[model samples]
Target: MTVTVADCERVQTSWFQLRSQVLGSGSWEDDGLTWANGDLMFPRVIDPAALARGVERARSEGASIVGAWLGLDVDPRPLAAAGFKKGWAPWWMAGPIDLGLPADPRVELRKDAPGADGRPPRAWFAAARQGGQAAGGAWAHLVDDLAGVFDVEVPEPFQRRGLGTGLMQAVCAAAASAGARQVVLNSTPAGYALYRRCGLQRIGTGITWWLHLPS
Candidate 1:
């Protein structure tokens, strides 16, 4: 079968539409967060100009900017031109429910929470011991299917280690196990190539348009 650009756009559009239905409407939200399927109208990181417009629009409609989103468009140029922040303000990775796979050697994969089997894990990790002395190794979490990813820190001293890959691998593996027909993520410029390495195809891209409260 073949797919067209319009098909892709529909998929993108519907994804956000679904998010809005399940979570909350992308209308004027007095609380500061609005949703449209998976497309976040408001997320965490705010874009000053567009955000101002968004807030105005929301306020005019009796809503407020409770949250903000950073746009992730297919064209990085537009985002750059808009001076939008490039990061995971929303969008996250998801896949098959129970990808019962091991967490490759030199790392360990385990359930993120106790009896989290049916609850859908927000995140998982492939951890390495902190040198028989320190605290946490490295970790990443699934912020649910609505938001793609939150953050991953390997620690300053832990840089250069292959730990990040292992952790991601483990997470993907679990997502696969969880019955996720596809693994999804709005990868950063740095991790974009890595997502390819891990077997995820670009399904759709989103833009975060936002307005923030004054500091």
Candidate 2:
């Protein structure tokens, strides 16, 4: 059951959709643009024309900044020409949910309860503490049997102590317990090596283009 790049893309989109819904924001697909409203909005663009339309729409809606996730195959020249500065290069990685890292005793995993209507939550959060102080945290979203991990962070002072790996182990364990068979994540350069050590392979790379509209 090797996951393809397309599978990773679908899971990423699902994560964003669930996030937008949970935040009470809106999302829509117009032409080649997939727009989701959030503090860090990524309007997935398929081509130069879609990028142009997305910029116009963001400006019309009074957004100060917006971003686009361009897959490796998408030419970034158009984005740069459109005044979008380059942003982070995130590696799309995926692997079996059993990451094999021993969980740290200090890490606590928590899952949201089902809604009043009995609908299960799409995501859960994990946090790691050192001496009863917050060291790091992360979020995992499940869409069907595939889970996507997001926002794994450890403070500077608390870093280099394996808290990041511990947080990942805890979240993957939680996802596996909840019936997820595979996990996917977009890893920045900082976390890329750690994720590789956890047995996830980089399936592809994506560039994020950011734009600040004129006032």
Candidate 3:
């Protein structure tokens, strides 16, 4: 299915909800979303100048700045020219629900992994070795057909063992079971290459900029 602007909005709403739970101590308004704990702000469909203004405002308030843009068209040159450090952000990947990525038999799938307030996982997936020596994890909150894969990670020792792919497959399955027709995820710069191997296509790229502050 082709992703549209409205689809992006729906997925983004779900993302903000998931991040608010995961990031903790964050605020969301009509203008944008902010995670106070991470000092991150995600402005909605704003231009480079507006984004720069927000960064400047945050810096003036004694907060180090981290900013994110949702789609591929993002350009951080304005922020960099304004003095913020520019760096690569995660790539947004999406594909049909059945990515054909296999789930490793050695990875145990768990439904009750720890979550906010020790409550039952609203939506979570974990893949771990029997002895717990290696593990991979991913999370999401499904909104209709869009399964926003919030985050995925595997430890250094577990790298290249296909555990990361298993974790992704596991999460995609979970989302499908929960009624998702499509899967979406933000791939870390490192995981971007890893995820592409699973038949998922990079649909768009997001930009992030950071400014360090003196303690």
Per-residue lDDT over 1-215 for candidate 1, one digit per residue giving the tens place of the 0 to 100 score: 23222333333444455445446655433344443432234243434455445545545544443333433433344334443345443333333323344464656666666343666654455565456633224333332232232244456675556655555666566554554344445556666654555554554444443333333
How does model 3 fare in lDDT?
A: 0.63
lDDT, residue 196, candidate 2: 87
- Kindly list the per-residue Cα lDDT of model 2 for residues 77-161, writing each as its tens digit: 7778888788888788998899888879988988878777987766888999998899989999887888899999999999888
Against the true structure, candidate 3 reaches a TM-score of 0.71
TM-score each candidate: 0.47, 0.86, 0.71
List where candidate 3 sits over 4 angstroms from the true fold.
4-13, 30-65, 70-83, 112-122
Q: Give the deviation of candidate 3 from the true structure as CA RMSD.
A: 4.5
The full ranking of all candidates by lDDT, starting with the best, is 2, 3, 1
Candidate order by TM-score, highest to lowest? 2, 3, 1
User: How many clashes in candidate 1?
Assistant: 42
CA lDDT, every model vs. true structure:
0.44, 0.79, 0.63
Top candidate by lDDT: 2
TM-score of 2: 0.86
Clashes of 3: 0
